[model samples]
Target: MAMNRIADTTNAVEVHGVVKHYGETKALDGVDLAVPQGTVMGVLGPNGAGKTTLVRVLSTLIRPDAGSAFVAGYDVLRQPRQLRRVIGLTGQYASVDEALSGRENLYMIGRLLDLSRRAARLRADELLERFSLTEAAGRAAKGYSGGMRRRLDLAASMIGAPRVLYLDEPTTGLDPRTRNEVWDEVQRMVGDGTTVLLTTQYMEEAENLAESVTVIDRGRVIAGGSIAELKAKVGGRTLHVRPVVVAELPSMAQALDEYGVHGATADQAAGLLSVPIADDGQLTSVVRALGAGGFGIAHMDTHLPSLDEVFLAVTGQRAGGTDPTDPTDPADPTDPAGTKIEEFAA
Candidate 1:
């Protein structure tokens, strides 16, 4: 394990008024993003939200119709080669060659990056062990589980030890447990002084991994801030109290209403009444007021707004609501090669 270091003062990535268009659709409508060295910035949005377009522009795979971008302080348009040298990108699906062994796939990537044959093999071994794929290194990637394949794809991206990494929904089809494992690896990567730009539908992943978040909706940035900051934009802490008996629900609602607090909608279906509190003092008052009403509280919980709530409030749709596996949706357009599927097309 490597000790985390402070990022260099130089910004690893900066995008100023970037715009990309596909026919009549605007994939990136004057989107701006800045990523400091050795930090993580999570780009969060639903399908067709232009997350992939932004990643493609930043990674040098696609050109923007307008606006300029810089990676490692090099202009993306004029110095694409330089930008490519310092950045790595892993897309939604695993990009490893299934016919190749895990070690072979990594070694090939290392070699492609101009590492010496021996050096490539050594790097492959190191990464295989680090990603816990050493035991299966010699097995064909097709035989590896989805988690292993995803890890191998990530290891391949690190062949050149990039200073900035772009992970665009790297855990799309992964199970919950596998997703956590990938999350831990990402934390380790950022801790090792690598600046990461992540686009994920998982709100919890954003909360866990991102130092800051940029929320996009309909090809535009609707909000950008730290997790807590974004949450505050939607609302304050929620005071939830569940009475022991269903008959007491009305009393609880009345008590909450007295403080100008509105109950959660019938959609929540928590069998509890909730009110938004402005601060900890309000929380204290709510508790005191509830106690005075002689309401036997079966449970009480105060919750800050989650990223899910923030996404809903900002986008008018829930995160992870769209079926990622749907083929007909233009949000996921397959390339002619069928090897690189654009998972979030606008």
Candidate 2:
């Protein structure tokens, strides 16, 4: 593997005051970001919020109008060739050739990265096994499942053993099961020390994989922090108190209010009293109130705000909408006519 070529640096990626404009439309507006080495940093936003634009800039696929970026300790502008050597990118769609066998797809990328014929074959074999494609190594990718194709594409990106990876909404259009499979592969790579920048709108995906996240909107970063921290910032926990019988819900709500637990609402259908609490102290009060009132507690759960809730709180809208595509963010450069792969080899 060529991963040993990676530079020793505290942060695998750093961007400062990056600005990219597509004519009059500002795609990125003075965005700054940092990803600590060997961690997964999730870049989240609604559609057309510059998630892909940022990834393109970091991967050297497109240059920002102003500001600078460095990936794997190589300047994105002055040392793009060196940076490309240590980074891999998998875009929204699978980039594998449908005509090629799974093994051929990986081998071709290995060869494109300048591996010798024997070395390319060995690397292809290793990745196929690692990604669980060994059983279908000889089958054409055209017949592969969506999950299989995604895995193959991920394997191709790893052929050069890149020290950093950029995944731009890699789980888009994937089923839950398929997305979980991709998440597993990504986790495995991170376990071996590859820093990853993942751009996605799926809250569950980011919550599962990212150690920290940067939330962007309208071409700017609105918030950035650990999941728990962000959740705490957005809202407090919801205390759900389910009673043993439906008739007890009204009494439960009344008792909670009498005990100084304000904003308690009863759901008659589910027979639960929902209270929004700021901290654990309120939870103890609620427990004591229910016990003192002789309420039979069927279940109780305290749920921190979900990522979707956090997204809405930060952006003032949901994490996804039908936003028109920005002209500058072209289709994956891995197209047959593009030079992305060849540049990596160079």
Candidate 3:
């Protein structure tokens, strides 16, 4: 492997031609990604697509077989010790100790990161209040709700005020309200100049939080861009029309096809006709044609291709499942967080 590519100084995280393997398995085959400073880059893929392996490499939990990666102005391979200090990682499962109190967990992490006892205590108290855990700060983590433990784990990651945070499925099984709370915290971190790389199975979460997204499948990137850019790249807006009379569906399809509109499809079960529209002008033309044909519309709307649809079209698979190579499993000895504090202090 050769380091012929120049680093992108503006990016808080940059990876190029990264490859990793397990026995004969090519978990990551030449994956490339970049996340600009102070923004979120969503990594999406089906199970076993190497999403977690890439995270482990970037976080310095494991080394890549080839290529290069730089985070927070430090090379992941050459500057791993320095890199560890400026980065925080939270995996799919909450890694906080259940026997410890919420406040104690944060304080312990702070202390391990080399904060003075007084400083660690102050930082713990600050985070407990910031994450709205002050009321339950003294309670053992085992007794806390799922959402509470999640917030505490997140708070632990921020104890060192990292410059880059890696959140790998941070909101996996939480309810909607708790998920939104986690989203809010991520936004706040980015607002304060911390870069974030998020990997998740939820399309809505990516749409709401990611400034840009990169889709990977089978250890390679299939698509990469902002939500709008990816949607446009996949296909243009689709016009959905539901006629008031179920019997008129056939007529409506014929009318649309006759109006020079191509690829119009009818779903008999939903009683709706969908066609891809090239532009707003075309949408208007279709509406006028429908009106002139005496077709009464019950509902009509147009929207760009959704992330979920884009993912399926590009990867030929749905967005979520278990990634066998992912070390988020508690039993996996290579779990990134296993020695998080020690690595940070080193």
Model 1: per-residue Cα lDDT over 1-346, one tens digit each:
1122223537788999999989988888888889888989999877777999899999888999999998887788998877788888899988899999999999999988999999999999999999999999999999999999999989998889999999999889999899999999999999889999999876667888999999875577767888887766677667777778767777677776675555543213567777777777877777777787787888878875554465556544222454558653322323221121233441
Clashes of 3: 1
What is the TM-score of each predicted model, taking all chains together?
Answer: 0.77, 0.75, 0.75
lDDT of model number 3? 0.82
Off by over 4 Å in 2: 1-8, 236-308, 315-346
What is the C-alpha lDDT profile of model 3 across 17-95, one tens digit per residue? 9999898777788989999988999997655667889899999989999999998778899988888888999888898
Question: For candidate 2, lDDT tens digit of each residue in 1-346?
Answer: 2354354669999999999999987789889999999999999776777899999999998989999988877889998888888899999988889999999999889888999999999999999998999999999999999999999999999999898999999999999888989999999999999999999886667788999999876578878989777666667778988888879888888898899999998999877788998878998999999999998898999875554455556544222332335432222222221232233224
Overall local distance difference test of candidate 2: 0.83
lDDT, candidate 3, at 130: 97
> Alpha carbon lDDT of residue 271, candidate 3?
92
- Cand. 1 TM to true fold: 0.77
What ranges in model 1 sit over 4 Å off?
A: 1-9, 236-248, 255-272, 275-308, 312-346
Best candidate per lDDT, number?
2
Off by over 4 Å in 3: 1-8, 236-264, 269-308, 315-346
- Model 2 residue 10 CA deviation (Å) reads 1.4
By TM-score, the candidates rank as 1, 2, 3
